[model samples]
Target: MTRCRLCGSEAMASVVDLGATPPCESFLAADQLDQPEPAYPLHLRVCTDCWLAQIPPLITPEETFKEYAYFSSYSTSWVEHARTFVDDAAARLDLGTGAFVVEVASNDGYLLKHVVDRGIRCLGIEPSVNVGAAARDGGVPTLTEFLSPDTGSAVRAEHGPADLVVANNVYAHIPDVVGFTEGLRALVADDGWVSIEVQHLLTLIEENQYDTIYHEHFQYYTVASAIRALASGGLALVDVELLPTHGGSIRLWARPAEVAGEPSQQVVDVLAREKAAGLQELSGYTEFSARVAKVRRDLLKFLITAAERGETVVGYGAPGKGNTLLNHCGIRPDLLAYTVDRNPYKHGRFTPGTRVPILPPERIAADKPDYVLVLPWNLRAELTEQLSFVHEWGGRLVFPIPELSIVEVAS
Candidate 1:
């Protein structure tokens, strides 16, 4: 009797199931190692009514984001991406000092810092205490609590409605997707716009990105699904932009009810394209389980062969996507000696489920393993360039998804 969170449809089918796994970001300290890691069912389902791809109800927001460990400033590309977003949003929305900008799940003030620099009033709603503190230190006013209808009303009572609300890569993390969007409607002014960026579900299936299936991500959205979800909260989609970040993503711009903006042709075109590709059809998600199985077999085989050959393998980027991949493939310290992450919070900790040690990138230079597995495959080019020194040891970079391959650095 599992119902769709968006459309209230009881008709749902299991699309892909990754089994039980630990919360992706729940990295553990050495002292905490003695405690057993809690795991939950990580299964995906498709709603027949709305065509929304999503995970079965399992964890809540309070459980997932409280005291979060991820800091966005650690990634160079993410920082630059935030900067570009601020610039583009400012110009597109004609925003200035008079306007107010609000970002939900504003991790470490990565994007708000730029908005504040332009003299615009910016507010951040971040549930993670440590990350919110970092955002405050970076000069962005942040509220450390989950965004809900009550919280949204309280924020509106104090600061009035916002001119722009930005939610980058956070739309999927919410358990009550309907309530979250209703809160967005309450916080935004009648004529104000809300922008949401999410990793596209179409891109995930096409690119073999089963790694993105984790408990933290409750929903995998397509434009059609998003349109339905937003309209349910009395919002309308006015524009859509395809972004290269996070492998492939869609940035959707929406406005409050009765407020109209020129709907972009890109929005119409993409919706039509998704329909043509069968995203709206029940059969579209039928083959996903098979695809996921193939990925698991391929990755496991590669890891087994590498271990047998005595090739030292290590992981790059302790991102949530990496956790899903590692846990699904049953990768442990035996297969991956350790993982390197730029985020200080994750450094010195061990990845959830896999329990592989996490260290700084400097470890790569010190250990010089025979192969470095790039987990954040979206940033393969950037990561490869950063670790080009592997060439000195005649080591090659390996990527398991899309396909397993060993790449040699050009001299």
Candidate 2:
């Protein structure tokens, strides 16, 4: 992007240029495989002024979320994480039956369902019609609408101001960062708390998590940049928590400017860490593009060697990040026979640009492939245990990110 989405600056520097790829989640149907698939330049640039790394918003949220293929409930670990967060938040915020909780971009009511179970008043603001319907079917009070300043105000008026506003893994999704933060401000009561969980730029750079960089994520944030972004919309960062989810993420605790005091020591420490890592300068990003190339080369070499040796290699989980890894490495069905996922929506469909078939999770066991390339490597521990049955066939699991590593799962 020529200008920063979070800050109005033209001093953008290169972080990594991933060439061109289609929307990461735009899986193809069998009949539409022949149709021309469009691709966009998937380059990431960091603004020197604000230190916010972002890609151009070539595609809108509606294009991707209207009928999303991903369902949060499919990931057991993620559901448990949500449940733990709800329980902790309720006890920490002293939320009782009279307290109200609101979650933005509440996919399938994964988190809010816990609030409902606790007898707390809660509402979910979901954008996708299908997933929103699924949430309602599960007994969640949901509003099928995008979060804008106007929408936030309307919701606040209709159902009173929220005592707790929880936005997990969505702070980086919106293109208009300032407006979205304002919407967050409008939804919460004056003294109410807001918690946002987003992938930390520090972890993405250190762990070589390039697959998470896509058009859907308009911007990536370091704690220093996040503080500035939050201040732009009159929300003050009060505290911070380091989380292990999504490889590594940060949970920001904020409040209205009038009520928010000085940030906690945790925020100060994380900002110091980001600064020490040289993220705000060009030093930290110089070797990233090279590292990304290594990941692509290493994965391809392993796949090609397996093919030449007459060994079979299949993939596990058809996540959006997997599509990025597939397209970046130019992997096809030949390199990866096919991938399997727990989500039925992706069954029988093909990956966006890679065009690899997506089969049911059962296919891996039935086919008895020699190796299972784990696509959603972020969930390595969880998937490794679930796919441990492959040990019966002496099949191993392969992880391509954070350096290619293969291990045998013991039965």
Candidate 3:
């Protein structure tokens, strides 16, 4: 961390440290509970030179992604988001039967299935063995391998150059940002498009979404930094779209530098907005650590008060981000009881570091706790509607991010 991962600059400024936390997705099995668990420093720092916010590469991508527990299709809204993106991309890019599409880190073929349905050729390059197998079973042409420059060139040789390369929610995962960007450049045709969706650093700082900072996510991105990152591998940011996914995200539309003539007005406008927010300067990041501390204090206060009142407060969704919040707040099963998730893989497992049991989603309805503390608050709308049945038992949903708030959903 002495030198910035993205830029070779030694100038770094602190941006909230969550203390040492385990890899967020490393759920523990019952048998492994007695063994020693590992944790790493979960500190974020911003480069004054490049303005790319990053954590050190304490863990490798192989350790986390080889057998990933996260299956994208579990969330109905995210699947629909992927479907909508595919439809829009096909129409926008004029993708035909002969055209080719490729998605990197494509979990369970959620997005590429739409491309397959359109009779267009598509391939998914995924690193996780389990999820990649699921993608193949779902009729996607998937390669179970991480995307390096060589891997990208090999895929191109085998499947030909892709017309549209989709990389959603994965730009921040890689430690070798420049090499990964070059791999992306190798996969895409000279005239093709590359679409990437990542959580916006501007919104993250402004809205108090510090939970998204974890070892798995090596970097956070602003439009200004993102533009610089893209150019590392000869890609140009041609357009930009602000999205509400993952709390708040930016959809970066890029292409080969040769054909990427000029960026859209949207990109220009967003850059102006970022500049006004003081992201390029050190002003925006200096206060983030304090805000993050306030979040931890507020959440802990609420949970302790609930415990003292003799009211039960359980958690919903064992997402990776939730682990950060739980570990930072030092919440255990005593305060949270047990959390439930829709993913059966985690039903009998425990959250990494925090040894809270993960049970089935039905457990919430069966138990009818006084308050269901939602961990995946990014999926607020969909989860609220889905968990509204709790209202039948006079129960409510509590969201812990961007300040704690409780909602009484209509049954």
Candidate 4:
């Protein structure tokens, strides 16, 4: 009888249960192996009242982000993405010299660095100690604590309300969605704007991207649900944009309820599409769970067949999504010799639950495995380009989820 975190609605339906899984990024230290790992039931539920998709009994932010290992600066595409966001936002908002830009959950100041370079006053609120230190090193003033109503009030009192507040891929991580959004209300100036980007639930279901289900990400959002959630916190959705990053994401621009701004056509169009697609109906939830089960079956069959044929398989991108997919499919080192990641912090560590060793991308060249399983399928194009040398050795790249396909190099 798990109730909805937002509306306290008991009329909820189970979407997909990922079974018990370790914290997606809890990469193990050598000494930590002696202790038993803790895994929780990863189940998703949808509320009929609010149409919000979330997990049962949310974990605390401190347990989720403190000493976080996932760094945004490691990925080249992510860095470019952040730069583009900073450039576009600064231009659109006319943010210049005296304007203050605040980024919530700013990992290592990836986007904030670009803001700082433009001679604007920028502040980053990061909960991760290691990441906050990195931001500090880059000369971005950072606050190392979770953003709450009290924290937001303190920031407003000290530095005054911000001109632009940016929260990229953080809307889903916060358990107290209403409180966090209310905090935004407290910290943003009357004329200020707040921008948030989250993985679109409509796209996740349509694309069968069940891999995005991890403990750190407690909720999935739709524009319809988001507008309602924000409105409850004294904000209004002013505009929305579809971004290609992270499979598919929705970038929403919001302002205080009293501030008048022209709502973008894109926002209206997307909302209509969501409603037409029955995003507010219970049937949409039913279809998503079925699609997810099919994905599990298809992926498992491919792995078992590959293993029987004596084909060597390895994985690419030790991302959190990849961790969920691996654990859900029950994939271990036996099925995957090792996985490669660009992040140095994860290179020597073993993936949670699976215990698959994460190696540097260079290892792929040395081993020359027959098949490389691309985990972060959203970045397939970028990863394939980097691992193009595999084609020279007659090896093919395998994409497991959504469908099983072997990408052969064009001669």
Which candidate gets the maximum lDDT versus the true structure? 3
- Residue 196 of model 2 has an lDDT of 97
Give each model's whole-structure lDDT.
0.88, 0.93, 0.95, 0.88
With a 3 Å backbone cut-off (N, CA, C), the pairs that clash in candidate 3 are none
Query: Each prediction's Cα RMSD?
Result: 1.3, 0.6, 0.6, 1.4
**Runs off by more than 4 Å, candidate 2:** none
Q: Which residue pairs in candidate 1 have backbone atoms (N, alpha carbon, C) closer than 3 angstroms, thus clashing?
A: none
Q: What is the TM-score of each predicted model, taking all chains together?
A: 0.97, 0.99, 0.99, 0.97
Model 1, span 199-220: residue lDDT tens:
9988888778888888889899
Model 3 Cα lDDT, one tens digit per residue, 287-404: 9899899999999999999999999999999999999999999999999999999999999999999999999989888898999999999999999999989999999999998988
Clashes of each: 0, 0, 0, 0
lDDT, candidate 1, at 72: 86
**Residues 279-351 of candidate 2: C-alpha lDDT, one tens digit per residue:** 9898988999999999999999999999999999999999888888898999999999999999999999999
